[model samples]
Target chain A: MNCFKALLLLLLCTSLPAVEPVKLTDDGRMKFTPVFVDGDTRLTFVDFENPKVFRLKSMDWKTREVKVVHEAAPAPEFDPAYSIDGNYFSFLRTTGGLQVSLVIRNRKSNEEVVIAPEPGFSGYRTPAIAPDSSQMLFSFANNFGQDIFRIDMKGEGRTALTGTKGINIWPSYSPDGKKIVFTSTRDGNYELYEMKPDGSEIKRLTDSPYQDIRGQYSPDGKQIAFVSHRDGNAEIYLCNADGTSVRRVTNHEERDDYPTWHPDGNHLVYVAERDGSHDLYLLPLKD
Target chain B: MLNIGSFKTKTCSGIGRRSFLQMSGAIPFGLGMSGLGMVTADEVDHVVAKAKSIVFVFLWGAPSHLDTCDPKPNSNSDYRGPFGVIPTRTPGVHFTELLPKLAQRSDKYTLIRSHIQSAPGHPDGGTVALSGFEENPKPVKPNFGSIIARHRGFRGKLPPFFSIANGVVMDGGRRIEAYGGGEMGAVYDPFMVGASETGKVNIPALALMDDVNPLRITDRRQLLQQLDSVPRTLEKSKFRDWNRTYQQAYGLITDPTARQAFDLTQESVKTRQRYGQSVFGQSALLARRLVEAEVPYIQLNYSRHVEAITPGYEFGWDTHLYNFSLLQDQHCPIFDRAFSAFLDDIYARGLIDDTLIVCMGEFGRTPKINVRAARDHWPQCYFSMWAGAGLQTGRVIGESDKNGEHPITRPITPLMVGTTIAELAGVDSQARAEMRVLDGGRVINELL
Candidate 1:
């Protein structure tokens, strides 16, 4: 999708002229879990699990219907981070031990490249593809705390960006690909931190005694909308890239968390606890 | 200011790091309480004689000297770019049109047209500028402001030092290092105030009413706390220190005076309009009010974030290819107007005489335009303008080459500038400068 189109949809959320949203498509599959394939047009996410059959169903926004984007993707996995061009989709694959497999299926030739040729990495899951899709960032454990590491897609080298002794997870990159914003349990609570992709000049974006986790930048990187518990509940908070203008977006009695903005930013998918059941909900942003 | 009416209050915020304020026998800001109960009324009412407040306008990114500070009229177009040079009041001195207002009021301040730092990167430049030390080979250093808050405390309940407009994280890897006290501790850190969606200065901590019955609540909570403690008094111990800070913090949760300082309502609509309604300008106005509240220092980060971040909002002064357009079309317009308004307003309000305003970035923009027509970081040469307080002013103390590439005259060090600030604060220049990472460096003697 065009950055403008996606953000135009997202722009309905933030009318500020400076921050145009990265556009995502409005396919009519009751589209909820939006994992970008590329642009605002292509999107795929888990949808419609037949309770009788108990099987995962997939939907593609580009086609605007419940189509077979992929057949047998597993459970405990969602939100596939597509490549910048969105020709491929990579999600965490659980096979024996938890491993992240990049199921790179070229739409043009209908060819696929699975990075995980075999089973491994009980820890490596929730893979985040870089914009260029040349590398992947995810969480892992070692002597240091549960930190996020980036591995080259071509299997060249795996580099750990957040080597803090505290837990640093939910590694997400800005649309510009200059900085990385992640959540860290440093200072005795989860706060937000942004740093260069090379892990230099790290800056703290949030300062709270409460848990401030699951932060992601809008497609334009002008604003970061994250889920924070600063307001006595897990609410969606929006702030500028500089960590200013922080405002809460969600204010429901239900538990609202896991917010992923649409490529256009006009909408976001959240895991809200309504009716005593945790289910995926699409919040149609005003934008 | 007298001890007679000064009964101590309780804790403030329980948030980790610096929100834990410790107020006890130790007069906060470390002002020694030597003659306990002996201070007369005259001493209490006496106006604070020290004109030691600080107004730090932290420009994001290194600004391009070739276009803004030092112009090269004779240099090639690619090098000189588009700006035409204009003469200033001082004979033989010139500035780019980017600083038209600053140029007119140049006499009120001193300009170091050619200061040098080694780091060409954002975090490095900020570290060097803030700490008065190179960013290399050291994990941390105390900033000059942090040192001031440590050695000399605030005059009122206001924070000893404060930062307006800055909530953006920069190069420093961990913690809130932008307005920091590296190892000297977080207590000396400046209280942050900026525009959030809620429009409050610092994030609103819980507060209490001034007329609220503190005695009843204290009696009730003190009784409750006593039931849990073995000692009868629950006083005068490390735990008591913790409890007192906790209690004052509790008082802060409800106090109106603490929140009123951040009230934009205090200023009339006309005043707010006079200072641009934009976040940056309003932030500067708030910074002045903070000064009025006796906050010693304030830093206003012009930019929002560290990167090009979104559109139209450049945080750091790192203008690359797109920078010139931003500087011309969007960036410089904000700076020239906001700064001129601040300088003029502060001076007109008579706060300028005591409040020292220092305006500069981590480094200078590249002398030459790059592939994108924007300048990258250049630490080799730069310029800064300082005014107010007792520090010497009206003279351009240093010089850069025709293109603003490198210093041609007095290439002062960051340490000298840091020492210069110490001198203006009435603190022992050499001693306080030593307190900063730029230890042992004497005040910049030439300008004085």
Candidate 2:
């Protein structure tokens, strides 16, 4: 009976046409914090099979193969950004369990560098590389609170881009490389804000009672996707680049968070909790 | 069991008015006649009790002994970590600079630096620390509070014991077995009260308060009739044990004094601010009120979350990474402030001699810092701060090695703690033997 069931499942998977909001993991473990690249064919995410040993993993659905991007590292790595050519990527690494730093690694050369090392600060998070791959933007933390900082690719000559008193995190570089978008809590609640790459002419993009965090610009630079807890629980939300025309994207009673836009721009990948397990799902935006 | 508190004619003749008055006159002494007219041998010797109540503050996730109570500044950097050490009020003792409040007030308590747990995992260590027994598949041993409740029997309107936490301490699939009555059955279970993230007190069993008001029982006769209509089978089965629980619940609702024992609103704003505005601090304040009500045992769990470092959700001392940052930024500050306030409040209320305050965790963190800059679980050597109960104050009992790994003197076990608490609470060895609990438990004589 088990053999027959397995054969039936195989047949169904082969016969059915691909559908939207397709689950990409079946391990019955939490798989979240996903980033999509390579024309949305390849995906990278944090897999929590063992809650203690979180792994940076990648899966190619077309080839039906999975690989570990970082092996044997226990601390949480956050906000992985792939360069335009996908050859190099930059992410935030937390060591000593809570001290956060920026790590730029070359997957081919297998060499890694720790840039923008946290001296007296707690760490940094939400790293974004410029379109030209010449600089990186990240939120740095100190006793006063968190502010966004920019550094050159060589891990030298860091500059403070935002010196707000409250938290300013989840910075994303716009496609044009001239602008940066991020979330801030200066007004006492987390809201989206946009500023130039040099930190001039800061404008508030969103204003809501609920917390809006982890905002990312679309590949086409026309819309922004972010996570908000306004509707009782965390759900993915989309708005115009200027923060108007707001709409809910995915409405699961469970949490839907960490939405990462795909290269194609029509679809996005996010972490969704369903039936007690967290897995990655691909959802196409509705017109 | 229904006549557990009643007298039989086979013992003695009915007392006359003259004899009753004479017996009542001796109540100032150890005449053994309780307010309910029921007497027991334990009550006859109640004057010997060193402590009328105990506030067992369980630091759910183990804190680093080296970082808190047993700092090893002379050791290498791997053992010392980042913070510098400061001298306490005691001549020879010192604590980490992170615990400035405790350092300044170290004379108010006794620090046992050689306390050891049986196992290292959260559940195992918690079981041994609270119940004085290793984890096994069979019936779990009752915690000291459960045993006290059993020994003391019903005291008054309030339950004899209480566990103040949002919920039970949980680690994955397992939990702290000592949180309840354990093998002695649920009848002796400590009444569980939860303090929310917003610092509101709630009792899980009393959540179905739809129309029922403790202050206003609209139909007393109807309620009594329904209570009497329980089936005979249920009356004879384990369900019958709930009768006492229901009576206690009813009394807690209608009796203003009982309700006041759990209310934080009655405290002045300055008093509440002294304890800080955090949930753990508020829970400590509630524990103090329970002490005021003369509740025998109260366990105030710091945070239910044991492993992960998810701030604003749960707080435990399990620092797998960024141990220093977390201790500096969050854990130590809250504990230092709230605990200092608790000690001051108790002392000012003159409860210091009549109450026993024990502050410790399941175990201690590793002495040497791991590569993660966090300490792992180390059951070999830990520290427990004992105050009140007339224990010798401003002293350090036992010593850890230079590296803070093992004990250099006699090691203290959880069994000794259980025995000491039980003994101080007036549960004699004869009573423990009769109850078949703590069969060979030995009291820590040095603590006295």
Best by TM-score: 2
lDDT of 1 by residue, A138-198 (tens): 6654442455778775544778787644556677888878888887755544678898887
Which portions of model 2 show Cα errors greater than 4 Å?
A: A1-287, B1-48, B209-244, B305-308, B311-315
Please tell me what DockQ candidate 2 reaches. Answer: 0.02
TM-score of 1: 0.50
lDDT string for model 2 (B115-233, tens) is: 77566678777888888886576598888899988988877778988888766766544678877778988888878786532245776555433445444555777556545664445
- How many residue pairs clash in each candidate at the backbone level? 51, 2
Report the number of the highest-DockQ candidate.
2
Error of 2 at B200 (Å): 1.4
lDDT per residue (tens digit) for residues B116-212 in model 1: 7655566656777777775445556767787777667644566677666535445423222435666676556565556521123543221212233
Write one digit per residue (lDDT tens) for candidate 2, span A1-287. Answer: 99999998766432322345877665534455688766567787866543233467888958747888777665656557777666668876656434567798766786787864544324556678888888888776553446788888766778888874456777888888878888876664567899999998889998775567778889889899998766645688888899887677777655677888878787778887553345677787643
Runs off by more than 4 Å, candidate 1: A1-287, B1-50, B166-168, B171-178, B196-200, B204-254, B306-314, B429-437
